[model samples]
Structure formats: structure tokens, C-alpha cells
Target: MADDPRPAARRRRPLRAATIGTYALLTALALVYVFPFVVSLANSFKTDEDAANNPVSLIPQSFTTAAYQQLFQTDLPLWLGNTVVVTVLVTAGRVLFDSMAGYALSRLPFRGRNAVYAGLVAVMAVPGVVLLIPKFLVIKEFGMYDTYAGMVIPMLADAAGVFIMRNFFESVSPSIEEAAKIDGAGVFRRFWSVVLPMSRSALITLFILSFQASWNELPQMIISTQSPSLFTLTKGTAQLASGALSAGSQFPVKLAAATLMTIPVAVLFFVFQRRIMNTTAGGTKE
Candidate 1:
């Protein structure tokens, strides 16, 4: 009855303690990370005086929609429209181009394929800030500066998205493609009709990521275009934060813009977060 019961009990005691400690640490970290967002959301509904006086408070002293109304009266609608156009184009382009590049790197045997992939990986390691000047120069040289193309084209495909897609494509079974090949399906046909259909989770994962990245991208948007008509949400929001749209440290207006900027991406993520998790966990063969 008491055969080694103390030893087993003692072993479980440490594990239980460790688990509790881990949960406590994680809960603390979650609060730390989420506190800023909570404060921002709260302040968006607050009056300017209340927001400034109680910057970190989670409850507003007086709630009002004046900040949002002010935003709508400014260039916010134009910014939103431009952001939608650029984000939609960039997301679609990244999904298509990254998938094609990934498939080519994964399946198509070619000269310098490994070298190209290595270069792509290296590109991912470089900080984006380091490339800002170069991107600006390239956009200028191509005469894309101050144009919608400049804003959307430079961000159409990213190294990270390509890397993700390539990894996902590598996980797909070759046998499926081989069977399709036997039935006179060309590479493009196989990719478009066969492989792509089976890659729903990866595609959705890529779509969500691409949408978020393009929607929130600032440095690239700044370097890409200078036209007011081309101002995306990120760039416009930065201007609002800098007090361009109002005076007296308009925290409510700034936070309101930021809060609205977050909504679309947040909604998209909530809708497809499960698919993203599945893609990261593992792909299944059908």
C-alpha cells in the first residue's frame, strides 16, 4: 500500500509547483503586454483632459465619441480608402508571388535554386530599417515614388512570407504531384488546381499575415510615397500621433486612430487564427 508512495508524491510536488509558477509568470507577461492596448482603448473614448490626466487608467472619467468624430472629419476616410486599396493589392500579390516562389524553390529543380533560397533566408535576417534607404532609392529610380504603385509594389512580396510558404510547400507530399503529372497535368496546372486546393490552411495563414503586415507597415509606406492621396493608415496614423490633425496633445484622437487601425487586422486574425495555428502545428495529407 505504501510502496514508494512518498517518492512518487514528492516527484509530483515539484512538477505541480513548476506548472503553477509557469502559469503565474505567463499571466503576468500577458498583462504586461496587453495593458498598453487596454489603456489605449480606454483613452480613445475619453476626453482629451481625462486621457492626459490619467494616461494609464483603464476607465475613462468621461466617455465621448468626439475623438472618432474628429478623425472622420480629417483625412481618416481617405487614409482608410488608400489603406484598403494598398493592403488588398499587397496581400493578394504576396500570397500569389510567395506561393509561386516557394513552389519553384521547393519542387522545381534548377540551377542556383539553393543559392537563391539561401539569399532569401539571408534577406530575412536583415533588419527592415537597414533597407529603408535602399528601398527609397529604388522607388525613386523606378519612378514609382509618390504613386500608388510605389506604395503597394515594394511591399508586394516579403522574404518572411516567401520563407513561410516555402516551408509549407516542402511539407506537402510529392506523390500527389507525381500522380497529377501522370495524368498530363503540367506544373502550373498541378500547382493551381491540385496543390493549392490542399494548401488551404497555409494559404489562409499567409493571407492573414500578409494583410496585417501591409496594413501596419509604416517605414515602407513612408519611403514609398509622399502624396497625401497615397497615405495609408499607418502613415496617416503616425501623422495624427505627431499632432498634425489637432493641438494640445490630442491623446484621444491619436489613440482613436490607432484603435481603429487595429480593428481590421484584429478581426481578420480572430477569424482565421485557428487555421494559422493548424498550419504551424502540421499539415495533413489527404
Candidate 2:
């Protein structure tokens, strides 16, 4: 018996068409997403006149590092340092505090646990942007203005972080915690050694989130500090964008600052990216 070419051809036709359509759609989106970064990276090395004149050009009309040089001459370094400090502290604090509070809410049979969890849900509903003025008021009232403690302590714990941790803990099996509890382990000991270890995936997810949030945070920085020396990367970048200190004619400097500020986050996202993605999204196939 001879193979039927017609049926085989018919079977492959739909598959081939679907594959082609998927590739086409993906290619269009890739171009849309990557084109801007490509343009920004190219323009960063361009001279001010070149950047302005050839805004859309992938190639620089005149290549120069003067913009980068001038950024170093300004308060760029200080801003970068401030941003790093705050991001590190906030990420660490959120991971520890959120996890502890969450474990208590999820595992510990404490008084008013239900009410406390409900209160956190309510707090999370209140938008962060709307709290800027209110946060400033409290910070000033506590006389924590213009200090490192002020900038960090107020944001040390977030309601959303707690809620996320609580949800993640709930998703975990309670038997493991119960086993540890029956094994003569105290609450902190069981949580620190057993429960938290089991929650590595969730913790990594929270750490990445906290780092990104504190790093990109602009409004919080604005409300927290008034001194020029206390400015974070985002704060300083905005000031530069609005023609602060430097020659307004030059844009390479601003673009360079933007590009450099993006490096740490880009590196973070690249490293441990799979773990971060899987943890936040529940699960993914390789």
C-alpha cells in the first residue's frame, strides 16, 4: 500500500500555519519591546547635538564619552550610593519582617489573628502613592526627617509583603510545621530552621520584588528627604532631566545616568531570573 500524501499534507498545513502565525506575533512584540532599549543604548554614546539631531538613529553621528564624564563630576556617585544603601536595607528588612509576621499569622494560633490579617488586607488596599503626604507627616511628627533611620524604618515592613508571605505560607503543607512543632522546636526555632527553609522560593520572590520596588522608588525618596546629598538615583535622575546643575543642552549625560542606574537591576533580573519568575508565577515549564 502506498502512503496517502494528501492526508499527510492536510495534517501538516494547520500546524505549519499556526507555527508561522505564532512566530510572526512574537517577532512583532520583540521588536516593540527591544527597539527602545536599543535606541537608548545607541543614543547614550552620542554627543548632545548628535542625540538631538539623530534621535531616531541607531548609529551615533558623533561618538563621545563627555556626557558620562560630566555625570561623574556631578552628584551621580552619591545618588548611586544612596540608592544602593536604601534598596539593600529595605529588601532585607521586608524579607525578614514580612516572613516573620506572615508565619505568625498563618501558623501561630494567636489572639486576634483574624483581625490582624484583615487589617493588613485593608492597609494593602491603600495605595502607596496616596500615602506620600501622610508618610511625610508621620515622619516629620516623629522627628525622623532627614535621617537614614527615617528613610528606611518607615518602609521596613509593607502590608503587601506580609500578605504575599501569608499566602505563600498557606500554600505550603501544614504537616511539616506541625512535625517540627512536635519535635521540641520552639516557635522561632521551627520557623527559622524549618518553615523558612521550606519557603526559599517565596523568600526569593519577595527579595526580588522588594529590591526592585526600593530601587525604582521615586515618590518615597522625594517625600523622605530634602537634602541634595540624600537623593537616590531616581530622584537625581529626575532632577537632571529637569535641567539641574548640568548644562541643559546636553542629554547624553542624562541618558548615561539612566543607563548606568539600570545596570544593577538588569543584572539582578538576569541572575536568578528563573527562580524569581517561577516563584512569583507559581510554576513554569522549562
Candidate 3:
């Protein structure tokens, strides 16, 4: 008997429709998400009047480098340097400490481990804003206020990052570490060579997250430091928008600063996006 093609065609029709609709929806969402950045980049090259006049437009009517020139003349360079220093230290510290804590929580069976895990989960639920005042008091009491130490130290470890690493470590095979131990490898050696290297995806995820968090952090930076020399990109940019560097609304200058601020994080995410996706899809298995 000859097979009929009608049923096959019928099955494909809805599938094709669904695929097209899905792509259309996703494309629309992508445009919506990308529109603001495009507009901001365009405005950064425009004069204040042009930006104000065509705020929603993605093209500059009159191009000018004045905003960037004016921005460079201010404390932005110093702010960038400070942001870089704090971000690198904070990211590095979080990656190291969070991974260690996570490994312990996942692999090291100890007294009150459950309690510690529960505490971390609870901490994650608590709003960071609620801790601002308490953090300030502690920093002040420690005499670390207005110092880079104050800025970098408070953000060194995050409960969420620890939780992420712990979950990733738990998913990995226990036998890997067990074998390393049987080979006479010490705890630290096993963790560094066997466990850590296998958890590359998780580590990169933590790095991207920690870098972005520290880079964009505003409240902690504000609470920790009052010195202009210690201003991060977020704080400095806020000041610029609020008329610290110039009188009235310097729209172009503010937009230019904001545009520049988004670049690093964007680049980081794109560079590691495949790694993130792969880990998310096929998480490490025991």
C-alpha cells in the first residue's frame, strides 16, 4: 500500500507555524532588549540638544566627540582605575573563597554542615539593601571606611556564589576526589588539581557574575567610601548625572558614561555565554 502524504503535511503545518512564531517572538524580545543600548550609544555621540530632541532615536543628527572629551577631562579616568582595582580584587576573592566554601559544604561532611547550608539559603533570601546600614556600621567601627579595603573586603564572598559552586561541586563525581585521595593527594591538592579544573564552567560562571556584581555595585561602594578618589564607575557616573561635574543636564556626557560602563560586562558575558549554556544544559553528573 502507498503511504499518504496528507497526514505528514498536516503534522508539519502546525510545527512550522510554531517554529516561525517562536522565532518572531524571540526576535521581537531581542530588539526590545537591544534598543536602549543602541539608543544610548547613538546619543553618546550626539550633542546635548540632539540627544534631548531625539532621545528615542538610534541615530545622531549632529555627531560630536565633545561628550567624550568632556567626560575624559573629569574624574572619570580615576574612577575607571578605581573600579578596575576593586572589581578585580572582589571578583578574584569571591571566586577563591566562594569555591572553597562551596567545596567544603558539598564534599566535606562535618558537624553542622546542614545548618550552615540552611543559613546560606536564608542569607540569599534576605535583601541586600537591608544590610546596608549594618555593613556601614561595621566598616566604620573597623576604621576601614573610605578605604579600598572597605570596598573590596565586604564583597569578597557572596552566599549566592557559594551556593552555585556547592551545587556544581555536588553534581560532580565523588569518585574523582576519592581516587585522588587514594593516590596520596592531600585535600588542598585534590581540590586544586582534580576538582577545581573539572569545574571550569562553574568557575567561569562565578567569575562573570562576581565581576558584574562588583563592577555595577553602587550601594556598597557608596556606604564604604566617601573619598572621591575611591569612587567606582557606578558612583562616579551617578555623580556626573546628578550634576557634580557640570551644571544642568549634560545628557550626552551622562549617556556616554553609561554606555562605556555597559561594555565590559557585555563583553564578558558574550565571551563566556557558550560555556554558561553548555553547563546549564548538561550539568556535571556524578
Top TM-score hit: 3
Expressed as tens digits, the lDDT of each residue in 1-286 for candidate 1 is 6587889999999999999999999999999998888899999999989998999888888879999998899898899999999988999999999999988998899999999999999999999899999999999999989998888888888888888878888887788788889999999999998888877888898899899888898998889878888888899989888769657889999999999988898899888877782553343434
User: Which candidate's lDDT is highest?
Assistant: 3
Q: Estimate the TM-score for candidate 1.
A: 0.91
lDDT of 3 by residue, 198-253 (tens): 88888989999999999999999989999888998999999988888666568889
**How much does candidate 3 score in TM-score?**
0.96
TM-score of each: 0.91, 0.90, 0.96
Which scores higher on lDDT, 1 or 3? 3
If the candidates were sorted by their TM-score against the true structure, best first, what order would they fall in?
3, 1, 2
lDDT of 2 by residue, 236-259 (tens): 999989888555566688888888
Ten contiguous residues minimizing lDDT sum, candidate 1:
277-286
